[model samples]
Target: MADLKQGSASHQHEAAAVIQKHFRRYQAQKRYKQQQSATSTIQQHASRFLARRQAARDNEQEQRAARFQAVMSRHHERIQQLELEKRAIKQLGAGELEAWQARREAAATTIQAHWRGSRQRQQLKLSHPALATLRPVACSSPQPADEPSCSTRPISSKVPSNHPLLHSVTAAGVTGLHAEPSTASVAAWPAHRAGLEQQPSSASVCSGVGYSSRAAAMHGALRGEASSCLSAEASRLSAVGAAAQQPADAPRRTAALPAARRMVLERQVQLRTDAFKAAPNALAAARATQQESDQRLVHLLEQHTAAAAERLKAAQRRQKLLQDAEALHSQLQQLPQLSQLPDNVTGAHFALPGACGARAQRSRQAHALALAEAKVGSKWWLPLKALNQQLRDAAAAAEQDAGSTSGSASKAAAGALWGAAGSTGLLQQDWQQQELMWKDSWQRIREEEQQRPGLQELMQQDQALRPHVVIEQELSSESSWHAASMQ
Candidate 1:
C-alpha cells in the first residue's frame, strides 16, 4: 500500500511537472505573439506617421515651387520686355553716343600727352649739356650806355694763365684791344673781331703801299713792309688793352699776345653766324610736319566725335528700354500671388509695367509675365535676366526723372504737368512728394524732347510706361482690371 501511494505521488509529481512545462511553453508562445502584435502596431503607426509627414513636406514644396515659378515667370517676362526696350533705347539719343566717343578720345589724348611729356623730359636731359653752352649770358651786368659798357667778366677759371690764344673766346675777352681801352671798346671788340678775323692779312698790308717811280719801287716795298709792321702793331695794341683791364696784380700782356687774342675772338663770332644759317632745310621740314599733325588731329577728332555720339545714343536707348522693363517688373511685383489666384482668371487682367513711358501689348506682357512667374517652380531659378531688366529700368527712370526737373524751366513744366495730372490718391501724393527729390538734375530725355521735334519723335518711339505703373495695377486689381496703355 505504501509503494502504491508512493507510485501515485510520483506519477502526480511527474504529471504536474509536465503540465507546468506545457504551461510555461504556452505562456512563452503567448508572450511572443503579444510582443509581435505590439511590434506590428508600432511599425504601422510609424509608417502612417512617415506617410503623413512626407505628404505635408510635398505640399510645402509645391507651394514653394509655385511661388518660385511665379517669380521666375515674372523675371523672364521682364527680361523680354527689357530686351525690347533696350533695342528701342539704342535707337534714340544721338548725342549720347557722340559724348561717349568724345570721352574716349579725351582719355586717349590725355594718355598721349603724358607720353609726350615723358619723351620731352628725356630729350631735355640729352640736350641739356649743349644747351647750357649755347645759352645767352644773362644781362645781369649793369649797363653803362656810354663807353659801350663792357661788363668785367671772370675769365673761365678753366684756362691756365699760361694757355695760348686757342682758349675759349668767352673766357678770354679781347685781352688784346687798345692801349687805354674804354669799356665800350671792349664790348664792341667781339662783334668787330667776328667781321675781321677771317680776312687775309694781305688786304690790310696792300692798303698801306706807297706810289713813287724808281724811288717808288723801293718805297713801295718799304711801304708794304711798314704796313705789315703797322698791322702787327695794331694787333699788339688790342692785347695791351685786354691786359690793362685785368686786375692790377695780374701779369702784363706781351706785345704779340694782343694780336693773337683778337684773331681768336674774330673766329668765334664767325662760327656762331655759320651755325645759325646751317639748318634752314630742317626748320622747313619741322614746320611741314607740325602742319600735318594738326590736320590729322582735326580729322581724328571729328571721327571720334561722331562715333561717340552714336554710342551715347545707343546707351540712351538702352536706358529707356530698361526703364520700361523696370516698370513692367514692378507691375509684376504688384500683381497678386498667382498661387492665390483662381485658375479661371486669365493673366490678361494684369497690367504690364514698363521702365519707359510707352505701353506694351497686353497679350504679350501676359504671356511673358506668366512664363517668368512659372519658371520659379522649376528646380533651377534664373534671376539674372529679371535682375538685369530691373536694373536697366531703374536706370532709365532715373534719367527721365533727372531730365524732367533738372532746370528752372523743366521744374516749372514738371510742376504744371503734375498739377494737371492731379494727385488724386495716396500713391500719387507720394510721387508728388518725392518729385522734389530730383529737382536739380537735368535729364537728357526731356532736354532732347523739348529742344528737337525730331528728338521728341525719337523719344516717343523709344519711351515706355513708368515703372511705378505696375504698382498702380496691383493696387487697383481688386476693384478694377487695369490695362496698360500705349498713349
Candidate 2:
C-alpha cells in the first residue's frame, strides 16, 4: 500500500509540470500577438499621415502653378492691349497731322487769291483809258495864261492923214484885224479889253493943215491902242505866213491849232472830272474787297487755331497713354520671377475677403461695392459668385475622391485617377465652361440694366419736380425700384 501512494503523487506532480509549461507557452504567444498588433497599427497610422502630407504638398504645388499661369496670362494680355493702343495712337496722330497740313494749304491758297485779286484790281485802274488821256496833259502842259507869245509885230504909219473916210476905214480895218480869233487871242483878249477901256477915245480928225499935227497925235494914240490889241493877232498871222512858207516842217502844229486846242481843253476837263469820280469809286471798291478778304482770313485763322488746339490735345493724350503703357511694362519687368518667389508664403494672402470684417472695413467695402455697381452695373457679381461656387465644388470633389480610396492599391489608383483627370483637361474644361457661362450671364445682365432708367433720368426728374411740393406716385415707385436695385 505505501508503494502505490508514492506513484500516485509522482503522477500528479508530472501533470502539474505539464500544465505549467503549457500556461507559460500560452502567455508568451499572447505577448507576441499584442506586439504584432501594435506594430501594424503604427504602420497604418504612418501610411495615412504620409498620404495626407503628400496630398497637401500636391495642392500647394497646383495652387502655385495656377497663380504663375494666371500671372503670365495677365502679362500677355496687357502687352497685347498696349500694342493695340499704340497702333491706334499712331493712326490718330497721322490723321491729325494730315488734316493740319491740308488746312494750312487751304489758308495759304485763300491768302494768295486775295492778294492776286487786289493786284489785278490795281492794274485795271492804272490801265483805264480816261486816266491815261488825262495823265500826260496834266504833266506836260503849262497853264493857259503862261503860253508863249507869237513872233510877229503890228505896223504903224510915219505921217498922219486928215481924211474922215481914211480914218474910219483904218479904224474898221484895225478892229477887224484884232477880231480874228487864235490861241494867243484866247489868252490875251481880257488884258487887251482892260487896256482899251483905260485909254481916251479921239473925237474926230480935221481935213485942214492945222489939223494935220493933231490928227498925227490922234493917229499915234490910236496906233498904240491898235498895236496892243492886235499884237497877238498880228503875230499869229505872221506865224501862219511862216508856216505856209515852211509847211512841211510845222504842218501838224499849224493844222492842230485851229481845231485841237479848244477840243483838247474841253476833253481835259471832262476826263479830269470823270477820273476824279472814278477814283473814289475804285478806292471804295478796293476797300470793300480788302475788308472782305481780311474777314475771311480772320475766320480761316480762327478755324486753323481751333484745329491745331484740338490736334495738340489729342497728341498730348496719346503721349500720356504711351507713357502709362511703358510704365506698366517696366513695372512688370521689375517684378520677381514666379520660380524665385518663396514657397512658404500662405496662399490665403491672395484670397479676397467677403462681407465679414470690422465695422469700418465693412463700410468701406460696401461703399466700394456700391461704386463698382454704379460704374460696372449689377452684372459684376455674377462671375465672382460662379467662380467661388466652382472652387467649392472642385474642393468637395477632391475630398470625395480622397475619401473613396482605401488601402495602398486603392490610394494609388485614386492618385492615378486624379492625375488623369487633371492631365485630360477635364477640370480645365469645366472651369472654362463656368467662365463662359458667367461671362454670358454678365453680358445679358449688363445689357438689360443699360436699358433701364439711368442717373440722367433721375436727375431730370429731380429738376422737373423741384417746384412742386407733392411727389408723383410714378416717381416714388421708380425711386423705390432704384433703391432696391442698388441694395
Candidate 3:
C-alpha cells in the first residue's frame, strides 16, 4: 500500500505540473489576444482622430486663405484711392504764375546789365587816348571863361581828305583871305622841339632866325606887307587863346583841331580833367551792372535749387505715404477674413491635410505596428539586444566559432564600432608616436625659446589641454558602444 501511495503521489505531482504549464500557456495566449484587441482599438481611434484633426486643419487653412484674399482686395482698393489723391495733389502743385513772372523779370535784368557792360568795354577799346578827352559828361560844373568848350570833340590829327571835320575846320581857319596851311607846314613843326619844350620851359622862347616873332609878321608876309612880318611869333597863339577862352556852355562844335596837338597843349586841360572824372563813374556803373547780373543769376540758381528740393521732398513724402499705405493695407488684409466671407467655402474639402500633425500620429502608428510585429516574431528590443550581445561576443571571442556565423551580419554592421575600438588602440600608438615627436619638437622649441625672447610664453599657451586627450579617448569609446547598441 505504501509503494502504491508513493507512486500515486509522484504521478499526481507530474499531473499538477502539466496542468500549471498548460494554464500559463493559456494565460499567455489570452494576454496576447487582449493586446491584439487593444492594438486594433487604438488603430481605429487613431484613424478617427487623424480624420478629425485633418478636417479641423483644413478648415483653419480655408479660413486663412479667405482672409488673405480679402486683404489683397482691400489693399488694391486702397492703392487706387491713394493714386487718385496723388493726382489731385499734383494738380494743385501747378500754376505758379508769380514765380514765372519773377524769373522772367530777373532774366531780363541780367541780360540788360550784361549788354551795358559789353558796350562799355567796347567803347574803352575803340576810343583813342587823346579822343578820350572828348567823351560827354552826364553831369556838369560851372565853366570859367578860361576853359575850353566842353562840347568841342577831338578829331584825328592826320585827318583823311574825306573826313567831315576836315572841311569845317579848314574853311574856318582860312576865312580871313589867307592861303590855306599846307600839310607840309603843319608837319614841319619840330618833333624834337615839341618833345623838349612841350611843357613850360626857358627854351620855349627860342626860335629860328627866318621865323616870324609875332602873328602880325606872318599876316604881313602873307599879304605882301612887310609891317605885318616879324622874326618870331608865338606858334599857333591865336588858336591857343581862342581854345582857352571858349565857354564851357558853348554848343557842341565839330572841330578838326589835331587831337595830338591839343593833348600836348595847355588849352584843353579842363576837358581832360572832365574825362578823368567821368571814367570812375563809368567804371562804377559797370560794376553795379555786373553786381545786379550776379544777383539775378544767384536768384535763378536759388529758384532751380528750390524747385529741385521741392521735387525731392515730394518724392520722399510720396514714398513714405506709399509705404504707410502698403503697411496699412497689409494689416487690413490680414484681418480675419473667414469671419467676413463664409460663402466662399466650397464642398466638403478637408481644410487642412493630415500632414500638419503627421509626425506624432505617424510615431504612434509606428509604435503600434512595431508592437504587432513583435508579437508575431520578436520585439525590436530583443533582436537589437541579441544583435548587440552577438557583436560584443564576437568582438571578445578568441574562439572563431563562438560568435562566427551567429553574429556575422551583426559584426558587419558593427564593423565601424569595432574599427573605432581598434582605432583607439591605433590612436594609442599614434599618440605615443606623436608624444615622442612632440617631445623632440618641444625640446627643440625650448632650445629655440632659450635663444629667442617671448617664445616661452607662446609655447606655454593652451597648457591646460594635455589631460583632454585621455578624456576624448574615453568619450569616443563610450560613444562607439552606445552607437553600436542603437544600430
Candidate 4:
C-alpha cells in the first residue's frame, strides 16, 4: 500500500511540473505579444507625428507663396496705376491745357452772346417809343451864332403847317400810315436823314412811319426853300421809284439833281399823271382785300373763343363726373361688412331662412346699377366694373352654394348678416343718391351743350373763312387822303 501511494505521489508531482511548465510558456507568449504591440504602437505614433509636421510645413509654404503672389499682384496693379498717371501727366502740356480752357470759355461766351442778342432783338420789337426828338444839321451851310442850337430847342406840341416837314410828308404820303406819336415833337433832321441813308425804305416803313416821315421832312428841308415847291412835286412822283432803287444809286441821284431841275420836274409831272390814272383800280383791289381780311379775322376770333369755351365746358364736365365717382366710391367704402365679404359667399354666415336669397337680390341690384354706371366714359369705369364683377361673383357663388347644400347653418348665418345689412336700406339709399348725382351731371352737361353754339354752325363758319387770319396792311385815313391828293 505504501509503494502504491509513493508512485501516485510521484505521478502527481510530474503532472504538477508539466502543468506549471505549460503555464510559464503561455505567460511568456502573452508577454512577447505585448512587447511587439508596444513596439508597433511606438513606431506608428512616430510616423504619424512626422507626417503631421511635414503637412504643417507644406501648408505654411503654400500660405507664404499665396501671400507673396497676393503682394506681387497688388504691387503690379499699383505700379500700373502709377505708370498710367505719369504718362497722362506727361501728355498734357501747359500750353495745350490753357488752350483747351480758352476754347471752353470762348464757346460758353459765344453761346451767351447769341442768346443775349436774340433777347435784345425781342426787347427792341416790344419797346414802345413815347416820343421822337430829331436834332437837325445844316448840310449846305453852317448856322449863324444867333441861331438856337437844335439840341437845346424845346419839343413842339404839334407839327407846324409851314414846317419843312410838310413838303416831305406830302411827297411820301405812305409814311403817314402809322400809329400817331404822342404830343411831344422835335426836329431830328440830321439823324432822320442818316437813318434813311442806312436803312432800306421798305424796312424803315415797316419799322415805323414816324421815322420815315421824319426822314422825308429832313430831305425836303435839305433842298432849300427857293426850290422847295418844285422839289416837293418832283418828290411825290419819284418817291416810289426812289424807294425801289438800290442804296448805291442814292449818291448818283443826289449828284444829278443840281443840273436838271426843270427836266426832272416835267418827268415827275408825267409820272404823277400816270399814277393818278391807275390809282382807282389799285384802291378798289386794296379795299376788297381789306374787307376779306376783316371777315376772316372775325371768323377766326369766333372759332378760337368757341374752342376755348368748349374746352372749359369739357373740363368742368370731367370734374363733375370725377366728384360723383369719388362720392360713390366713398359710399361703397363705408360698408365695411359688405366690402369684407368673402369672394366665395358660401363661407358667409346667415342666421335666418331666405336670408341668402335677400342678400343675393340686393347684390344683383347693386351689380346691375354699377354695370350701368360703368358704361359711361369715366376714369372710374374700371374700378366700378371690378366692384360690380366682385358682387356678381359673390352672388353667383352664394346661389351655387345654396343649390349644392340647401341647409348649411354657417351659410344661413352669413346670409342673415348680409340681409340685415341690406334691410337697413343704407345700400339702396346710397345707390339712389349715386343715380341722382349721375342724372344731375348728365342734365347739367345737356344744358351746357344746349346753351352753346352748335358744332355744325361753328364748323360751317370755320370752313367759310380761313383757319388762320393775317392782318391786312391798310393806310391810315390821313395817309389815304394825302395819297389821293398826290394822285
Tens-digit lDDT track of model 2 for 341-412: 454433232335564423433343344333333333434444344434433454455556666553344334
Tens digits of lDDT, candidate 4, 82-118: 9998898679999987898799999997787666656
TM-score of each: 0.23, 0.27, 0.20, 0.22
- lDDT head-to-head 3 vs 4, winner: 4
Which has the better TM-score: candidate 1, or candidate 3? 1
Q: What is the lDDT of residue 59 in candidate 4?
A: 100
Against the correct fold, how does model 3 do in TM-score? 0.20
lDDT (Cα, tens digit) per residue for candidate 1, span 267-344: 433323332333344446656776999999999999999999999999999999999987885564443544465544
Ranking by lDDT: 2, 4, 1, 3
The TM-score ranking, best first, is 2, 1, 4, 3
**Candidate 4 TM-score over all chains jointly:** 0.22
Off by over 4 Å in 1: 1-257, 303-307, 330-487
Clash totals for all models, in order? Answer: 58, 0, 19, 13
Top-TM-score candidate index = 2
Candidate 4 lDDT (Cα, whole model)? 0.48
